[model samples]
Target: MSEKLAKFFKLNERKTDVRTEVMAGITTFMTVSYILVVNPSILSEAGMDRGAVFTATILASVIAILLMGLYANMPFVLAPGMGLNAFFTYSVVLKMGKSWQFALTAVFLEGLIFILLSFFKVREAIFSSIPLSLKKSVSVGIGMFIALVGLTSANLIVQGDGVILALGDIYSKEAIVFFFAFLVMGILSTRNVKGSLLIGIVASTVLALILGVTKLPETGTIFSLPPSLKPIAFKLETHNIFTWEMLMVVFTFLFVDIFDTVGTLTGVAAKADMLDEKGDLPGVSKALMADAIGTTCGALLGTSTVTTFVESASGVAEGGRTGLTSLTSGALFLISLFFFPLFSIVPPAATSAALVIVGVFMMSPILDVDLNDYSEAIPSFITIIMMPFGYSIAEGICFGMISYVILKLAGGKKKDVSPLMIVLAIVFLIKLLAPKIFG
Candidate 1:
């Protein structure tokens, strides 16, 4: 069985064996398993049924990770993205006063457009056209955004009317537990402990239970049948799909997914020493297609945009070099279906710690940015700050793109900006200004 598995995954060529791949896969799943709890909680806030979203989240992840393994032959896992799901719930539905069905329609349309773009190779072209500085900024910006989310969700940070922001009560039991969990996770991660984040999450949950911050579930059973998807599945409202506002939503989803997947793939591939002579990832087009198809399937299953996870780096860091790692993770997700009761009880503070740790992991790329160049530094700064301050990934990207173009043109470095970027900046400007003009 080991020989056949190795042959199928080309493990020998990738310098990985079955045991290593299995361990890598387990590490990957451990780091990302927080999504099992977090995704359902966030989407349920948007009025979707919690059980249904839970089933949908696992199903979407299973299918997407499987496809990524079989087709792309890459060690990556796919799930509903963090920032994109928040945007789906908060920005699109709550802020815009749109129905969850309308938001699902926007996600569906975005996935369809992604499919078309991937088919024509336009997705790759668009990815390649973005300036390297902007790409690094996006990573750093998303890190800050995720960290802010963690702090806010854990009540470690709170709103202040006069001051805009302030620290929450560290003396509170929940806050204390969160801080301890964060400290443990940070130390473990710094020490290169495998599954350290997951361990910290579990430890936090245990502490919360002991401290009376969260209660144990009353249910006696630990396993149960998965919930049906019928409630939210295929519920998209297509009547206003072509409206300019909806189009903008779709563009935002597409833009975030493209860059996020590209960034993750690039980072993980480099970690695995899989990059080609030109520093380009081999078989990346297939990986992008897998991501596109996953988003479409996830929307149909009643979730947000699905994309490759940066947590896959955990697997790569464990010596994963082939798709077997992803396949192993997918298998674990399949088994996770019956354990919903166990996952659903995890407190928000527990997952919040994981988010904070992951956020710190993502900030390493900021050091690569050229901070001395104003043309580069200002846009990067805007991208990094606006994401957390504005509480919207799409808004940060929009402002970052617009600022990059304006600064470059002003600096007489017009040639540094691409035509696609200019068009994107104009689209973003229209999206930003249209509400005032027509309202």
Candidate 2:
């Protein structure tokens, strides 16, 4: 037992130090910190209280991420997912006219299905079925989507009646604050400063306060303990989960979250060298199970779907190689539940700068794709470009699949196309024509 325990922390064997691993851990945590507020912000808009949603966010992040470390042994973080929140708000609650409780119930049901499919290794098959071209496209497409998300979240971009959206005036207080923060972050990252995100955010908050652009709220009103296992013992509108509309919502949620998580985990694992020669990452099944359980747990905790974040790939690039990194991140999230007031004071500009920086970092994988070869290039290029333009992962995927099929057919190599690509192409055409199929 002593020898085994020693081996667990044997830095010499792994050739990685506590300092490096901890830095990697911090990198992973900062990358996904976008969720700490984004989840509650979205759910609050759907009529949930800030405190309750905050509690749910912390619990989901802590429990799900710890499970990823302990079970999957992957340096990945799980949290209330961004895309799924949109589905929960727009598809389930708004379009279906269902209560949030009923929508949460759908999330729970979808999670159960995800668990069972992952149990049967169907998750693995689905991920493997995505062509290399599509994977390359997904990476670049997601990069654009992430950058757009950063811009919109920071109010840098706003809607307009015409094709072009308005870019806010740079002289406005908000714009100036954001520009200053962005400048600081850009300099830090370009200089290869460690903990650049953390530094940039701290600097931004200080500047905002000094410039009188941000003010502290009342002390008593600013801080509170996040709810713990309280939600685990509660219930949502479970009885209505089987209704046709709810079922459709559940299916869509399940499809999107499962695929997204799969793509992110596999892609990150490959980059981190955690994958074997066969391109199989050890404990992938366990990771999927953790994700499914996290989604179920999120619904029970009064939140939307939970999934593994692609942001963890940032940590992978920094040399995070073990579960220790994930464990550190999960513990930090749990601790941050008490520091909500402090983090809440972090301006959107700082956070957006960090996100945009991370987006640029993740885009590095695009250069590895065989773009010089048209066979591998066109479909991937189309998919990558369509992601931000379409503003929907499903739409980007559809475009990729359609292009992959058409390109293969045109090249007189239809057999080279994956069967799933064929099916996706058919569905893409149907969705384009009917649009109600998703309804």
Candidate 3:
């Protein structure tokens, strides 16, 4: 079994062994395991059945991770994307007045477009079309947004009487547990712990139970059959898919999905020494296809957009360089199906810790934004602030793109703005103006 496993994943060629690959996979899974609780919690706010979303999240992750391991020969793992799910629930559903079904349709269409783009390698061109500053800002803005989500869910931040936001009761059990989880996660992470996020989650959950923030599940509920997807699977509403509103939503989904996967791949591939002289990953198309397929399948399975997880870096950092690592992580996601009750029982405070940390992780890209250039810094600043303030990822990107184009054009730096960016700005203008004009 070991020999065949080694030969199949080209372990020797990658200078890795089965044991190392498996360990790396476990490390990756441990680092990202918080998603099992977090994804469903976010999607459930969109009126999705939490259990169904949990099952879909697992299935989508397993399929995509397996594809990454087997087809792309890479160590990356995939899951329903964090910021994408947040946008689906808060932006598309709550703010845009779209139904969850409509949002799912948008995700489905985005996946199809992504597949075509990846197939023709057109995504690479699109990647180069956007400014690096905007890209970094997008990630940073989304990070802030997700962190805000964690804070709000933990009741650490509440709606203010006269202002936009206010502080919650810091002495509450939820607040205490949240801070505890944050401290635990921070300490473990600083010490180079392998599963700091997961450990913090568990520790916080235990504290929550002790404080009576959450009740323990019954014996039968702790380990049971996987939840059925019948409540939500294949529930996309496509009848009004041709509307301009739908177009905007799908386009927004594409924008977020595009950068999430591409940015993650660029960072992870670079770390793995998988990039060539031109700084492009070899066989990137295959990796992209895995993401596209995973997303399409996830939408049908009742989840949000699935994309490559940045936590794959945990595995690579642990000496994982081959597909076998992904395969191991995929297998673990499969095993988690039986423990739905345990994952589902975690309170928002516990998951908030993970999301906040993940948000911190996402903020690293801001270092790539060169603040020396006012032309770049201004738009980057707008992008980073608008996400949480506007309560819309699409709005942030749209405003950022429009601002970037306008600033460059006014500063006699038109050459810095791509034709694609200009076109996108025009569309953004129309989208923003349509509501007032139509009203």
Best by TM-score: 2
Tens digits of lDDT, candidate 3, 1-439: 9999888888898788987788778767766777898899998998889989989999999889888999999999999987799989999999988899999999999999999999998877655566767766776776777678778888988999999999999999889999999999888878987667667877998999999998877775678888899999999897988999999888878877776676567656655666565445777888899999999999999999999986676677666888999999999899889975665567778767766776676677678778999999999899889878976565777788899999999999988988988987897798789889998
lDDT-based ranking: 3, 1, 2
Q: Candidate 1, residue 97: CA error in Å?
A: 7.0
Candidate number with the higher lDDT (1 or 2): 1
Clashes of each: 0, 0, 0
Residue 332 C-alpha lDDT in model 1 = 83
Which residue segments of model 1 deviate by more than 4 Å?
Answer: 1-35, 38-48, 81-103, 235-282, 308-325
Residue 377 CA error for candidate 2 (Å)? 1.6
Alpha carbon deviation, residue 56, candidate 3 (Å)? 3.3
In terms of TM-score, which candidate is stronger, 2 or 3? 2
Q: TM-score for model 1? A: 0.82
lDDT (10s digit) by residue, model 2, range 1-439: 5345225645445456565556777867766776887787787666666568778887877888878877776778888888888777776677767777877888888888988998999887767667755665576676667677777777888786585677866676766777777788778778887666666767887888887667776585666766554533245886776678877788788767866786677557755656565446667888888898988888888888889887776666555776667777888788778877766666777666666766676676677678887867887777777767777665667777787888888888977777876886886687577766655
Query: Which residue pairs come into collision in candidate 1?
Result: none
In candidate 2, stretches whose alpha carbon ends up further than 4 angstroms from where it belongs are 1-16, 220-223, 227-233, 270-280, 427-439
Task: For candidate 3, list the clashing residue pairs, or say none.
Answer: none
lDDT of 3: 0.82
- Estimate every model's Cα lDDT from 0 to 1: 0.82, 0.73, 0.82
Arranged by TM-score, best first: 2, 1, 3
Residue range 150-241, candidate 1, lDDT tens digits: 88988888997688888888798888778878888888878887667667877988898899887765688778898999999999898988
Q: Name the candidate that leads on lDDT.
A: 3
Q: Least lDDT summed over 10 consecutive residues: which range in candidate 3?
A: 270-279
